[model samples]
Target: MSAANRSGADNQPGVLVTGASGFVGRYLLRRLQTEPVTVSTLQRPRHDLLQPASLTELCQGVDTVYHLAAYAHVNQAQIKTLYATNVDGTINLLSAAVAAGVRRLVYVSSILADPAFDQPRTAYGEAKQRAESLLQAAHQAGDIEVVIVRPVNVYGVGMKGNLMTLLRLLRKGVMPPLPRFTQPFSLIGVEDLCQALVLAAQCSVGDNAPIYALTDGEHYDIKSLEQAMRTALGRSQPAWATPKAVFYLGALTLEIAGRLLPINNSPGLRSYHALARNYAVDDTASQRDLGYNPRSTFYCTLPAIISAMDAGSAGADTSDTDNTQ
Candidate 1:
């Protein structure tokens, strides 16, 4: 059979993507267009997660709903906003999907929901966990086929996270000594994450599975990620690993200062906290069951991301200096 016939749902189920303007959403959209299913997107004007009426309409006749919209930032002021988007918005969308009789729902959650990181309080993770719980309840009620994808440290082109900040710093030749980085960190390329989302939407092997932790096959330490960034940028800078106590003290100072002053929230400190603890997940289940495979490594993919960012910045005749800060 042809690819179209093999994957097609015979027009009985269409696909709807939320957060269509996000980094992952962009890649997912590109991939979905190649599929035979009908595609619809929901985005807000400012936050752009689609209005309720539009969302309801899109949910109608949609077999799969990929819910990727969320307030992704982890800052003090963003806590409430995160709950509003990640929890409330998810409930709204899932409710609509239920009403529309959507066949499957793919929720993009974070590995922070693992409950391993107890201290420092991850608002994003809390909201995601709550949403997952809600979805689980719905699944129990037989409302729809729900698959929750918990991706870890997703980084690649168009990714805005701690790793991106490090890349920006590296490009500017500022290498900070990182400590408390012994934990094995997992990463998933944007493309691989998109593929997993697609597979989760289409897979019929399980019914309403609540959770899947998606990651690249291998894990890397903080030093390795930093070195990858350095290699990607073709910059050779000496970086010393500070003592964990000193690093935590500096991070605490910076965190306090950020709270008091207007500072762009740093993911570095949060990442330090994350990497200070073990976060390695076995994606073997996902690989064996859903055929989910990560395509690229941080070492291979970071350069392409940097190159694309550079090309875009150059094409627009915009200085990278302005965009980095």
Candidate 2:
């Protein structure tokens, strides 16, 4: 075990945030700025995970690292790239952090990392699971204190990915009225996730690495969610519901098209399952250990998200949005 992993720094800890330009990362940075810690951010081209050489010095003089940089799409074609970045890149960062005598690393993992959710997980989920295992091994070896936070679907202002795509479609009125899906899912606001990350970093280090699953502690089904969003956006509720078969057919078409054509962000079986499946998580440990009490719900934060979408604060690019979150 490294002494650095056990002892406190004499001065305020230096914190480094990877993926500082990302949706959640941006929110985390803003939250960190309000704290007393010295904050450092990584620029992508200059400090990339795949380029292990670039990561060598990233953890130098940093007491804690917030690792949020991840390839967050579910395209199977990019499986190799996903593993390289999520799994191998994480190994690179672990090496750097250990060598730099960093004390702790707070990793932002996703709920999809749990293999129990799917019989055969998406490539992105597998990659995150692999990364989490590696981080756990490092922690076991006493290389660093590891705190892993597995957040369910995260939504907030400047949010992108599957949820954002849905919001865009809804705003355009091109999306048909969705069928009521009774399967409930969990979600965390970006700000709440940021708070959870900070709590993970600040909480006492234990003999074993701790993994915290986070959500806003609210129940949300697709029908109620759609109603809330529609009401908030001033969009009319559809007079009739679109049949489930219609959506299934659309997903099947997209799946076949994805297999035949070069497409990104296609709504295939993975996205379909993500929306339709029940993926609720228990965050009792987060509450007990880190005092994690989430304040924002999807209902409360819908306005900010709608406002961001309308004002173009969120990007229109389909390259990245975490549908598999």
> Which structure among the candidates has the greatest lDDT?
2
What candidate 1 gets wrong by more than 4 Å, as runs, is 1-12, 46-51, 117-119, 205-208, 237-239, 261-264, 313-325
How good is model 1 by TM-score? Answer: 0.86
Q: Give a tens-digit lDDT track for model 2, residues 57-130.
A: 66777988999888766454776887888889889988988999999999988877888664346777778888
Minimal lDDT window, size 10, model 2: 1-10
- lDDT per residue for candidate 1 within 193-223, as digits (tens), equals 8898888887763444658878878888887
Each model's TM-score, in the order given? 0.86, 0.91
Off by over 4 Å in 2: 1-11, 118-120, 315-324
Return the clash pairs for model 2, or none: 161-321
User: Residue 319 CA error for candidate 1 (Å)?
Assistant: 24
Between which residue pairs do clashes occur in model 1? Answer: 43-48, 43-50, 44-48, 44-49
Taken over the whole model, the C-alpha lDDT of each candidate is: 0.70, 0.78
